[model samples]
Target: MKLKNILIVVNDIELAKKFYHDLFGLEVLLDSDGNVIMTEGLVLQDEKIWCEFVNKDIVHKNNSIELYFEEKDIEAFVEKLEKLYPKVEYVNHLMTYSWGQKVVRFYDLDGNLIEVRTPL
Candidate 1:
């Protein structure tokens, strides 16, 4: 089977929608009352409904998983992010590894870890 999409449970659909679109330019491919599918195979679901379906309480602020993205122009992307979210918390500011890849890590509005890295 082919991998399709990654679904994330979000507290506020509208807030998450705005955050993803503004930050990553992920266009909405499909949208309903509780779910939204974005361009890059990302699906955002309402936490309440997700919890109901999973039969467990939704956890927040955990660092166990991260949504990763790669950018060709990582420097420009980082500059734009810094300007847009001046006060946003960062897991790590822009850094280059010995392997010659640059990466930045930060939390989304719902406290999900997100990393943007250069292609290796």
Candidate 2:
């Protein structure tokens, strides 16, 4: 089997929805009283990632998940991300490594690291 949807615990549901929508342009697949679902491609064809915000004794912490967004213009994406999430930092300048690819990295909401890569 392949990996599927991932859940993120967020204290602010509205902010999370806005961030994800603005950053990645993910459309809302389902929205209820307390749950918010968003997806990119066909549910079974691609991954059905969902972000649910509940009012429980939940520990709002960052998981070991690194979300990556491939961008043709990494600089423009970075600019938009920075404006939305002020805590975003450039992990390093875009550089071609021995692996033969160029990449840049940054942090997203909840301090989860994200990488934007482009093949050279």
Against the true structure, whose lDDT is highest? Answer: 1
lDDT of all the models against the reference?
0.90, 0.60
lDDT of 1 by residue, 8-113 (tens): 9899999899889988999999999899999989999999999889999877768899999999898999888888877778999999999999999998877888
- The parts of candidate 2 lying over 4 Å away from their true place are 1-4, 41-63, 89-100
Candidate 1 segments whose C-alpha is farther than 4 A from its true place = none
> Per-candidate TM vs. native?
0.91, 0.64
Pairing residues by index, what is the TM-score of model 2?
Answer: 0.64
Worst 10 residues of 2 by lDDT: 42-51
List the pairs of residues colliding in candidate 1.
none
Poorest 10 consecutive residues by lDDT, candidate 1: 79-88
Any residue pairs clashing in model 2, and if so which?
Answer: none
Model 2, residue 80: distance off in Å is: 1.3
